[model samples]
Target chain A: MSSDRIAAAFARAASERRAALVAYLTAYDGGFEHSLSCLLAAIDAGADVIELGVPFSDPSADGPTICAAMVRAREHGATLTHVLSLLAQLRAQRDTPVVLFGYANPLLRRGATRFADDARAAGADGVLVVDLPPESAAILREPVRAAGLHWIGLVAPTTSAARCELVARGASGFLYAITRAGTTGTALAEADSDEDAALRRQLALVRAATRLPVVAGFGVRTPEHVARLAPHAEGVVVGSALVEAALAGPSVLGASVRALREATAR
Target chain B: MLRTPVDHRDDDAPGSFGRFGGRYVAETLMPVVLELEAGWNAAWADPDFRSDVARMLACWAGRPSALSPAPRLAQALGTAARVWLKREDLNHTGSHKINNCVGQVLLAQRLGKRRIIAETGAGQHGVATATVCAKLGLPCVVYMGAVDVARQQLNVLRMQMLGATVVPVEAGSATLKDAINEALRDWVAHPHDTHYVIGSVMGPHPYPTMVRELQRIIGAEVRHQLHAEVGKAPDALVACVGGGSNAMGLFAEFVADATVALFGVEAAGCGLHDRHAATMARGSEGVYHGMRSRVLQDDDGQLLEAHSISAGLDYPGVGPEHAWLHECGRARYLAVDDAAALAAALQLARSEGILPALESAHAFAALPEVLATLGFDRGRGEGRDVVVNLSGRGDKDMPTFAAQLLARPETP
Candidate 1:
């Protein structure tokens, strides 16, 4: 099943004594063909998991970089249906775990049960609905779990300990521990300061709350940043930086992913 | 004394108005929304909390705003209709926004929130929130669209003067919707210490119902005032709807009165087919700004930018309750173009010495259509009473009015 593939990816990374390198690319960032090339390139360059962003009109959680990529992807005719077809194409050639990252509106519009069945049919391993909190996750969780697709949960810096436990209980494939308090694409604070300490405390709390693999994302940009966060997290997700590289060209994105891969190795 | 219809109180479901309202926010903010729901429920049932808000409304913000007759405006419409203005403009903050602000600030205090954040379009809500924050000794932050900050400079200054920080949002559309996006982000980041004082009877749950309850005083007072003055309820009610707070306030009391007609005027920037903020006239059901209301969106469900000469009404969505009302035919919504609204503002100012906010002018501009719909004609009709909600004063909109209407004609 899809959850087994996600589990296998983490297990393999653990056996290799390195953190899993997860990369994100908005579907149709440049265009369908170019974006598909970028994703393939990232996988070839050593990304274990791919977070395929379904371009949304109002991405309130994202900063300028990701927001700009989504706008470009939309202009290039990317939609949820278009992204699912691209995922099916990618799945045919690779067994790498792929998570469909998007907001709730499209999924809600498509109806939860049908979206789960369609996503699974398209070879998506997981679904991360950005706006669906644990309080309302039941709306999507039942269908997703029934379809054997992992329903990813997110815990933010502002999330209280009690609430974190509630979120962790419903988390499936992994829990996304957001490193900072603000939206995605913001710069992380200095690695060893009060902010970093606070992040460490939050990560520790998350680890204490759930047995699921915890992946850290949002504001994770550089090789050194990955090296610093690898100890606390089982995986690291790189989004905006890779998107910036993808926007530049496929060659640049390949180099960027390779560099991140080498950083994860250390 | 006028009797409030018992059936109007029957639909008491939390966070929903006939499939139009629900919490569509991110998970990071869900716990906060749930907590707010519980707090609001407890507070609503508590007599002390209710009386405390009542006292604040009566003593601080000035309650029971006058219902004054507008003979000149009625005469100009060329109808035998007798028009009365529900004077919310005379409130402490120069608008009806204070009513909700006072109640929300009190609720925030009860919830142990020390800081407050809000989003504003015309700056009336921002000013009202800042005023209550100042009175309560709490720090306040207001997010406004960059475009709104430029147009509503007086309100920005007013908020600052009241010791609140104003953050200008430079996101999509740079208007009310964008400001709301920024405010929601802030709420997610600081849900523990801050309370988001939503300006209108819109957004997720609890908020739409809570704000409407606080504002219901407008319609409730109108019922008593009209009863004493005209010896009966007005035949029809008119109010402009941006997020539909003032209209909801005035409409709630008379909802079950089969004899009363409700008219909600929306801002049609240029026209309905052109750039306009008439969401009800040109919108589809979609989720945006934490509510599943009728939103101005493209075919792909992307929110479309709404435009209006009046900054207050430049929104892509209305309150969920308004959408329910429109769908069920409980109230009729109409669109008034920019030119007609401005003309009405000027006419009211000239004839009655009352300069109304551009938002309120939309309702005045619909006077003719409202009378025509009622089949009332000048000097040869049944005498019917009409009440139009003067939601705010024109002080803040004077600059926009001057630039648009009072400026000299350009020389070629």
Candidate 2:
């Protein structure tokens, strides 16, 4: 099962006294075959878990870099069905946990149960519906869990304590801890002591709420950032930076992923 | 005064209009939505809050705005039907937008929010929100699409003059939908101190319900005005539907009246078959910007960019209530092309000396056709009264009007 794989990956990283490197790449971003090759390259370059972004028309939460990737992927004729087919192809070669990261509209249009079934059949380990809050999660949770896929929840800097508890209770695989209070691709103020203190504080709050591995994401660009955030999180997710690299081709993306992975090593 | 009982049953369940409206936002925004919903409900139930809103509407917004009889317009159309205009164009901000803005600003104050944020398409809502925020001594920020800012420069200047910071959003078609996304992102970042004054009745939860409630005053006043002047309800109520606030407001009181037919006009940019903003005419059910409604989207659930001459009506989605109204057969929706809307605006101006906003002109454009369909003619002598919601004055649109009508007559 994908959830078990995610748990085991985190466990192995913990034993090695290092954080797990979670790499995010948009499916079919560089055309069907090239994007698949990019995913394989990321996994080979030491990405412990893979997050496959499903390109959306309006990615409100995304920053410019990811938005550019979406535009490119759309221009290349990437659709939800195409992404699933690519995932199926990738699953044939690797057992690395793969999660579909996207908005709710497409999944809702596809019908929640049907999407969960298709995703599981395509060898997806988990699903992170970015816009689906806990209040509306019932639309997908039962069907996803019943299909043996993890329903990951996101905790933001603005999330209240009570809501944090709810998210922790419902979260599967791991909780995604957003480091800042803004959209993805926004630069994190790693140089500012005050900003770093606040991020640490938020990370501590998220860690206290759940025993499951908490992965920190958003604005994580350099190895220095990964090193700085490794203590507070069990896993670090690098998205926009790697996506930018993938734009230059899989070779560049592989080197970038390897650098981030090496930075996670204690 | 025959006052109909306001139905609370429709909004009893939070964030739902049939199966349409729901809190389909990010988890980061869930708590804020719940908090805002609680605040709105408490304010709604409190008599003090109700009176406060009522007092502000009357004294501040110059409301109980006149319902003027448009005899000249009716005569020019060669129809025997008595036509009355609900003069929302006379409101403080020269538009019906002030009604929702004032109420929301008061609600934000009651909720103890010190800062206000809003998303605008044509800049009417931005100007309205900025006006209210300035009056209440609250700092305001308005997000407008870069494209909209370019087209509606006067409204942008108006908002700026009212002491609000206008941010130009440059993402995804650079229109109202993009502005909304930017505003939502801002709300997510500043959920504690800031209140998002959504311009329309199309967003998630409390907004559609709350904005509708505030706007219901339009219909309430029209009903009273018609009853006093003509001793009877109008045969029909007509308003243009963008995100549907004006139409919902005008239709709120009359929805229960089986005798009154409600008509919502959508902007058909060129025509229904061409680029248009007629969501109900050629749209499918999908979720976008927190509500499940009839939306203009591709087969893969990607939102398609809507086109319209009137910036206010250029949206891919309609309000949940309008969708429900169309589905249940309570109200009828029709599309008016840009050329027809422009012609109606010119006709009204030339005949009655009332230059209507392009958005309002859509309703006027559809009037003659709807009247013909209803079998009202000069020979019929029906004498059936019809009320058209003149939603805003066209002073701000003078540039577009001059550019389209005078500067270049032959070209669209």
Candidate 3:
């Protein structure tokens, strides 16, 4: 199954005693061609896994950077079908594991099982919906897992330990550790202060709740930020920062991911 | 660690009105929302909490707002139906919004939240939130869409006067939907200190149920007052559906009574074929702003921008309970255009001395349609009693009214 690719990628990083780099790029954000170039660039620059965000209109949990990008993407005629086709195009050029990330509206609109079938066919390894929590997303998860694709679980800083166990139960691929309780682009104050310690504590609880490879994310920017927090988790997801990099140009995005990947060395 | 306790159980159960309302927020907000749910449940169960909320509603919001007979309105309509008005317009904040805000801000205090945040399209909910926050001594921040801020500047000043920091959201049409998005983002950032007092019976689980129970006073009082006035329930109830808060409040108590016909009026803007906020008439089942409900969306499931002369009604989605009501055919949903609503507002002002908010005017505009369906006596004899929820006073809508006057030719 394509999902085994995720496990293999994490194992590859574990062999080197280094955290894997999970990079998020909004599919069709800068238009399809620009997004495809950026995706290839990120993979070439050491992005072990690509979390391709499908653009949504009402991204309530996302901050300004992502929200604006999503709007621009939507204006550029981005749709779920186009995103799946992007995944297919990416598959033609790369072997990097890709997880389709988005809100639940479009996914539910297409029927959960149908979405899973289409996603698998398009070479998507996993799925992560920001709004569909474990309590209400079983119908979605079952179909995703049934399609032989990994269903990514998200454990937030505000998630109780008991709830963490619930989210981890049927979760495949890896656990996405939301390092902060805020939206995507909120920056951390510093690298190794009390904030990191608090995150480390929460990461500990998340690790205890599940044996799935934990990837810490949200507000994760800068190589220093990644380096300071790398030893604690199996992988680190750089989202909005990478998006900002792509906005600067594809080369800047590549270099940003490259630097963040280097910092993952344990 | 910012971990909060969450009781994760079966989906579609918490605030479900037959598979309509459910908690669909992010994991970042899920636990905190669950905490709020638990707190609300505890508060509702406690007698002291209930009495405190009731007392505040009575003293602060001026509860039991007058329900009077619109005699002139009935005569002007030339219908046998005796028209009555539930004057939520006379409430302390000039709308029914204060009732929910009062209860929610108090809950914020009980939950030990230091700050309050709210989203508003028309300044009514924002002003009410600011008013309650000022009374309760909590710092308030209201997110208004930039377009709404421009249109409802008086409401902006009112919120500021009540000591709220008003933020203008500039994303996705910059209307109520965008404001709600910004507010939810704010809540995600400051989950520990701030409480979002959702203005409508929309959003996630506890909010829909909580807001409904808080505003249930509208219908509860109407049932009693109308019973005392005529020795029985009114034949019909009507209210505008802008996130369906006022309508839900008015329709909730009468739901069990099969005899009382319920009508929820939606804004049709210019016309049904043109720009409109007629979600029920031209909408599909989609998740929006954390609830699965009837939403106006494009083919890709992206929400379409809704249009209404009334800013409050210019929302893409209605409350999930309203969606359920429409689904089961328990109540009828109708759409009234901007011109009709404006005409109805003027008619009420001239005939009944009641100038209603543009949002409420939609309900007034739909009354003719509602009456027609109710089998009204064409002979103009005694007929059914129709009670409409005049949701707010039209003071804030004067600028729009004045613009209309300026645009019209002089009748010299």
Candidate 4:
């Protein structure tokens, strides 16, 4: 995938005011069958992208909800290969872009090149190895490029411009900007003045630092947040909100995504 | 009085101690880790916060345990060097480990974290963590190496008595590393409400830096004590280097003090020549538990299993800062064999009426080197004063010591 194509995809989505909902579900969140059903169900619920969580015993940064889900997934015998197969099944049924989210251990355990090749072949468009920040991209970048897969970067509220520049220089695909200073699966009460201003400033800084499309995430549970963050970012990636919606039931997910989509469209 | 660089360390906010520490974890975790960095940085700047922590240290754990001058102990070794020992051993839990445990648990409470998970080796740290958890009314779980659970049975019982769940980890040599892995797994699963109170100055990013900062009180007190008594700083600062928390704490204030040489002693087990774990003496660079540092590994890059008579020193990797220090020549690492360390433990018991933990004995054993290098004859007063950190009391090791002493045919 060319960088231009990724940028164009973000531009078109942004201009439509259609907030893209990125649904995150660990393959085997329940079991292989239930996970596949959930993946297809998420797409039917208006998920623009599917973030496939590969189960690893260790997730250095994830909070309790996601970590418990991952541990359950692993206990149910889910592996990277299993997740890839699930993703392939999703691709066969739909055309949604899939990004694999995981820590560095599993990827390192499998040689980077081989892991990238396997991921691309399994129908993944991008991979977010959670731990590979700007200072530590040497282990992943080249192989990801070689395998024709995008290496997505995550920028936090605390990332300084210097660090962001370094990460953006090497990043491909859309940049993921965290909304808060905490872990995944939880949202803070609306961003305070300091936090909101920092988020806006970081979004703007990240935009200037990289050519890639930037998507803001973390604690984005409502349509108001989607609308609020839309104009400032290339897109808004909703993980916990969508997962929470799915947990509330498929109807709730569809309703939430539709509401977000309508809000972003404005 | 010697001028040190703790003042210089103030310039690096978020993380950095004169090219020593910085955030090094991956992007996914950066937000949370950075938040912790900022919180801790701010905490350090607040005098009220420091005084509150200090109050806890003094009243709860009984601080200023004792800084007795060991002239007899020093003279017998022929260094004529005045050795003032800081009795961290008298702390509530009988080790310096409680100093960090109390500090970190307080931080967790401040952050509103309800559960605490930690890893332990000799179980001193586990006992410390458990004791704090019980005191604070927080849920605590400690992961212990299966091997350690067997060896330190009393500590295991103590942790249970303190209402902490002890999980025996059986993977990867079934030792401290395995326990660390299990604790990390638990943390990842409960990050929102749980804090992994790392016992030592190791782990990824904020942990190594944060834990060391908490342990820095050891140095801060030493600084004030040294100035009040000796009219000048000691010539050399020495401590055993396991995951290096104790040494780092004792040496933090003295790092940039050009006159005071910092020496870290690693356990050589039988000897450096023996198939032993000696990261400072014979290990290579490799990444384990998140950062690249001196690791005991084989040619193919497989981590060579480390061995030490002291369970705490059996870890294969040293802290990254220790690696950087070794590289920068700011600190020197010496190795002590098991016999030497054991002998030191016994000597301290007989002479000073203080039994030193085998792990702490490594620092005591390195005293001969201090004598030889500083041009101090055992009979003369020509050398500088040496401060050896009595890291932990030998209470936990009484069973091991008694058994070993009884089994020795050469013992009277």
Ranking by lDDT: 3, 2, 1, 4
Error of 3 at A138 (Å): 1.6
Name the better of 2 and 3 by DockQ: 3
Residue B301 in model 3: lDDT: 79
* Chain B structural similarity as TM-score, candidate 1: 0.96
Look at candidate 1 and tell me the lDDT of residue B335.
96
Error of 3 at B183 (Å): 0.4
DockQ of each: 0.46, 0.68, 0.84, 0.14
Q: Kindly report which residue pairs in candidate 3 clash with one another.
A: none
Instruction: Please give, for residues B1-412, the per-residue lDDT of candidate 1 as tens digits.
Output: 2332333332465577777887777766777888998998899899999999999989988887999998887788887778899999999999999999999999999999999999999999999999999999999999999999999999999999999999999878889988998888788778789999999989888889899999999999999998898788889899999999999999988887867889999999999989999999998887777888888877556778999999889999999989988887878999999999999999999878999999999999998888888787555335678999999999999898888888857411
DockQ, candidate 1, comes to: 0.46
Best-fitting candidate, scored by DockQ: 3
Which of the two, 1 or 2, has more DockQ? 2
In candidate 4 the C-alpha lDDT for residue A130 amounts to 68
Tens digits of lDDT, candidate 2, B186-216: 8877878999999889888878889999999
Q: What TM-score quantifies how close candidate 1 is to the native fold?
A: 0.90
What's the CA RMSD of model 3 in angstroms? 4.5
Ten residues in a row with the worst lDDT in model 4 chain B?
B1-10
lDDT of 3 by residue, B1-412 (tens): 1111122122337887777778889998998889999999999898999999899988878888999999788877777888999999999989999989988998989999999999999999999999999998999999999999999999999999999999999888999999999999999988888899999999998988899889999999998998888888888899999899999899888877777888999999989899999999999999889888999988777888999999999999999988888877778899999989988998899998988999999998987787778767363537578999999999999999888743677611
